[model samples]
Target: MFSKFVIASLVGLGLGIGVGSVPVLQDHLHWNIWVFVPISGLVLGMLFGWVQFTCSSLLNLRVSTRIAFAFGLVSALAYLGTDLGQYLTLTVAVSEPTEVLSGQTPIRQLISFPEYLRLEYGSRFIKTGTFGNEDVGYQLGQVGTTVTIVVDFLACFLVAFATALVMDDTFPWCQACNRYQCKTTSTKILFADEDRLYDVLDKTTELLLEQSDHVKVNAYLDLVAAEQYLVKPGDATQILSVTNYACNQCDNKTMVGKVLVKTGKNFSEAKDLDFMLSGTS
Candidate 1:
């Protein structure tokens, strides 16, 4: 768990820095095209969430809500830091001549950080025009800047929070083996009788679970001959998908079954028919 947190924090910080720097660079080149849309923040959050999920999966780390929230917070803070850093660099380091023989003057000498923030944010920073008319403008004052900051942070937080939770469900882990299960085989059967389909799936799962060796499990699976249940898609009312998973380092195995019912024009998974079984190989 500690390792997971450390890795997540590093990843969040790195990603935030990489993303935040792009806009600053663009601004320097006078080629900035960033539009502060809420949806853009959501998309960025999801991208961050995906990176976090991928890292956890690769490292075999279990992800929880707490870790996800921490990652979100770190990412948001790192991104905000870029903005503050840019402001400070401009105000404190960059100097402008006051007048002839006067001296170099830095913006820091005239305004503090808080005052600078209020003045800069209160000014019109973004403006867009259509063919010949002004179409959009953003002149968020101090109050609006505060609101925007909160909204942006929340957008990054909530989307990442939800994304991590959702992706975790798609992958199953073996607690006993302390690893992720690998899919060994999968078969899709078109069936007319739901009872027969269930019986075949149950029997297959039982036979595979009884074996102690992966080779034996594979041989038994072959004998089941799922192809015999295949039929034309147009003639089938339901489809049963059976997937087998096994832990490579141990004799643990799992079988997942899902049934899809054909509706008017599409097939939808039947939640009632979903089942999972786990046992020794």
Candidate 2:
């Protein structure tokens, strides 16, 4: 994220300077024009990050490819929003104050790429100078537009990469753990089905074995039986579950009871219960 932001910002600033002014004295241009001109380039560059984070958070999506795509798509949409914002400003400028005051607030219409590109260069070039002596300004405007497009595209790619890194640990890697050795709250909360949860609970028995300063692990169900149940909230779709987990590590072969709760779009491990199975298999 940092790299993309820095690189795009530099490119935008360079383009802003390169295209906003004219060259004088052979390849030398006055540095005066750049003092206040690259503000849009810099702000919009950082705005992309905020846009991605906002979109991802609103959806409550854990770090994943889907959320990453959502961020990139929204960032592109925001890029277009800037063009819409520009169009609205121009629209209000050309309309009378009476027209603006009456009726409703003006709705901004999104502009197409070709039209935006055309307007961008057209506005910059046409405003640079009066007709005949504007060739240099026209060329500079074209260069600036090209640079802007390139920088925007590069920024999009970088935001996608950053999204991947930012969201990588939002969800558990359920497939990596063997059923005989582990279970996760996600099996009850985040996942779509309960079969995997039951399967893991039924099979989870073995853990790390430490013997004579050497430790090894194996997979086997414990020699005990357990009871499980699903709890439901009143009129709400809360999917809660209680399970008596057989813990072989205990010297008395004591069982552990686990409760899981699903709240809205999130899942959590609830407080442990005193309930446990009494008999050993």
Candidate 3:
């Protein structure tokens, strides 16, 4: 949906603007040109869009939170580092830099000559790189840099999008299966515990979750669903238990779950460690 795009783009814009405003990125890299912000925004928007699109896998809350944060962190860094990142990927131009910049070790200067540096539709940006300059730069010609930018942004967009659904309140629990699941699909009963959250939740989950789900227990006295979900990925080493279940309708999990117990090895420490979901009551 466009919401994802908008969120990612907005986040990208904020990050790109912030990172681009940094002294090192704008000044040291000499990306202070008018075209730089849009370019950076485009990259960030596409990068984040791609990361969140196809990569969204339903994961445990703790793991999903980390993954979401990872998405933002990578987006920020990537937006800040697109200049050097592209160059380091062996994208240097065939011709050497003709303009020798003084003052700062500018990567290269954008120059235009009537003959060799003619500005045409095909000609947008003249890639320049000095052999020994750490502070690299790009010079824009009157023709402007658009073709490479569109292509580059498209590339970033295509190679993007992956996330996990954690702390989801929209979904419901499977009453027949004795687990939290999506209303439309019983195939999603699998869950896992986030290793990092184990210590934190171990201390707090009991204290915080001991109360009844029906009781208005939140700080704001909101009537919250009293439920916990446990998922075991192929890599899980522990088990999870829950007391409440949402009203989401899904397939019966008994057959599939039995199959899991019968054939699956190296599973979580315990099977059905918690009470079974009450039948449709």
Write down the TM-score of every candidate.
Answer: 0.62, 0.33, 0.25
Model 1 clash pairs?
211-281
Q: lDDT per residue, candidate 3, 1-281, as tens digits?
A: 33443454455445444544454554333222344444544545454544442233122122234444555455544553444332222122435444553343322233322221133224344335555755355555544555444444443433332222332222343435434453322222333434433443343334344532222222211111112133325654443323333333453321111112213565433443322322332
CA lDDT of every candidate? 0.65, 0.38, 0.37
The CA lDDT at 82 in model 2 is 49
**lDDT tens string, model 2, 182-237?**
22221122223466444544444223112211011111221111222232233323
CA deviation > 4 Å runs, candidate 1? 23-37, 78-129, 133-145, 182-244, 261-268
Better of 1 and 3 by TM-score: 1
| Superposed model 3: Cα runs more than 4 Å off | 1-9, 27-145, 161-281
Model 1: lDDT of residue 264? 86
Worst 10 residues of 2 by lDDT: 210-219
RMSD versus native structure for model 3: 15.3
In model 3, the Cα lDDT at residue 107 comes to: 28
User: Model 1 over residues 1-281: C-alpha lDDT tens digits?
Assistant: 68876786677666655664564452431112353455545766787777887777667777777777776776566555445554444523334454532353445566776886566546435566555665576665666566555666678778877778777765577898666777788877787666766776676566545643445544544554455445667877788776888878787887776889888878999988676767774
